[model samples]
Target: MPGLSLWLSPPPESSLYRALQDLITDLAGSVPAKDAPVFYPHITITSNIPIECDADEVVAFAASHWAADALATVTIMDFGPAFFKKLFLRIRKTPALTQLARECREKYVYGLATAEEGDPADQAAVWAQDEFDPHLSLLYTNSWPFSDEQKAEFGAKVQTVLETHSTEWTGGLLTLVPTYRSVDEWKPLASQLVGSE
Candidate 1:
């Protein structure tokens, strides 16, 4: 089964992009140079188990949700230690984002569910369910449980990096990607600019 996900891709000129590059560069110094995952900065709106839906339908839903705004603004408010097993930049949840997530889940996810569908229960949980603490991951890996001293040192480094950068970004692209295994395998099925025709 293909793993589908919705993502907000930050524009290249945004300060958030530059900050993410800097963070990746700094983090790369901590591990073997080849071990760092290829960086593609984005805030995942939701992830779903391979639902049979038209790609155009998914793109249309995203475009319609943000119809009035030419760009969706995201704020990177703070640096967090870990989420979903990776260090990340915590995003301040805004109503626009929250609503967008809700619509994606309702229209694409839960709306596709059926009683006879063999255990749709195992699909990834919907976003914006209880709390919408959106975040942009800075690192992606399975390694875990660093030594206390190492964690402290790395935490300080991440803090220092955050202090030097701006927090906000205007993302113009919404994409539907299908992944086979790792994030590196994600292939864009369709894309739409936030508000353009």
Candidate 2:
């Protein structure tokens, strides 16, 4: 991989990820093609750098970049949508997930050169740094056809649904895999966590 960044997300059991997937799948079924792919359950901790790909490279990367034992606890309570009009499951646990996200965020700052803007090589973009407001995205829509009333009602409905079913996530597993551009695709690589730190 030339341009890559470490990503952090709740493990499979995280209510946040599961809820987000369901929400997006249901809503995305009606949205445009551009909107459907945005539904992937992710809270990108850091990005914007061009690097190389190799098992050795990633192993060395994990050794220097990844954190070994960090506890990530997050709760899904409120329903919120991203600026893109996609709804998300919000984290309301006073940053139970922030600590883990920070480790990944720092990896970007320290690992390699951040990618140049306008370069077609970048896989993701930086919206803000370390302001890891973790939310699981659920919907995507254009701004042109939305009104205040629609947004408010959508949020309220989503919040009500989340309140009905949210699960606790703990004992996280850290897996360093290649960042892929598509579901049926992934670049192969391995990561090793630095032991000396």
Candidate 3:
């Protein structure tokens, strides 16, 4: 029942990506296994791909439809408290990225369906809840959801590490990842160059 999702990952060759990856690994190491999990640094485009859909078809759809000369420059804006976004860096949005997200949603989520058909009304309602708010999660933790003190402490640690690295993520891979039952189980299914012709 695991669904598919799309993410924009910084080029592995980029220094920024290496720094962020190390930060995530280090932070993930500090938290207990049940509290937080380690994940790659990525700006999620959409995480609503239905489990019923074909992965290869989705990958091909994205490959043919989406093309970007360069991904938006990601800036570490602020911190958040959501479980998936626990101690995360909010990224600045760009027109190209926004458009790309919308197109992906139209295909995978909306399923090219009208308001009255394809998906049931209730199902449609559920899919509509996801909005394209781009962010690069530094930690995925559930322990400090309501603890401001803990969140601030972690945020300070994140800020300290970020200050020593470049925050700009310009371009990378457009990847299709499976959203499994656990973060550790998730992995990329397909990927294409963002700026390739």
Candidate 4:
């Protein structure tokens, strides 16, 4: 079972990527010395559940719905701790960003129902339509579990690093990835440039 997902990645040379690298380094250093997995800076558009579907068809559906004018001027607004002891840099969600995500879900992940199928309501309800909380993850604490006191102290340190290097980046690309169990196992299936109308 392959888990597919759509994501927006910043160019490696971009300031956003640099900031993310710095934050990750800072977080990694604060944690107990242990192996930490590194991942690209991205904002997830949709996380596909394991289902029987053609990968090419999925790519085509995403390509058709890709909005060239939906390039979002993303801002690193703040920092926060998430579930699973992960720290992330919160992004200011814009209308373009939300609409882009919704469009991807509606067109590709959740399609219109047929009369014979009676709306496929169960599947249609999988993805969220509420407010989008976009962020770039800095690191996960699985390797170095933290106590409540440690979490508070580490969270404050993360916040300090984020505040010191607030960043802005324009997102113009959407990528389809076949995700496996680990971050290192994710492989790109397709990518489409989305910008400039």
Best candidate according to lDDT: 3
Give the C-alpha miss distance for residue 159 in model 1, angstroms.
4.0
Best by TM-score: 3
Worst 10 residues of 3 by lDDT: 120-129
lDDT of each: 0.63, 0.45, 0.70, 0.59
127 in model 3: Cα distance from truth in Å? 8.8
Question: Candidate 2: what lDDT?
Answer: 0.45
The sequence of per-residue lDDT tens digits that candidate 3 reaches over residues 1-197 is 24678888887777778878888887787675456777888888877687677777776676566655545564764555577877677777766666667667777877644667655434534443455678888887765643566556666777776687666655577787878557887777777765533
Q: Go through the candidates in order and give the clash count of each.
A: 0, 9, 0, 0
Which lDDT tens digits does candidate 2 get at residues 88-193?
5554423334544444434444334344533322211232332446654556454334456755765665665567654434333233444434432433344322
lDDT (10s digit) by residue, model 4, range 1-197: 14677777665556556766676777667667454566666777676533455555665665566554554444543333443227665666666666666766665555643456434434444444453567766775565345678667766766665566535555345677776456666677677654423
Error of 4 at 47 (Å): 0.5
**Model 1, stretches more than 4 Å misplaced?**
25-29, 32-36, 49-51, 67-84, 115-127, 195-197
- From the highest lDDT down, the ranking of the candidates is 3, 1, 4, 2
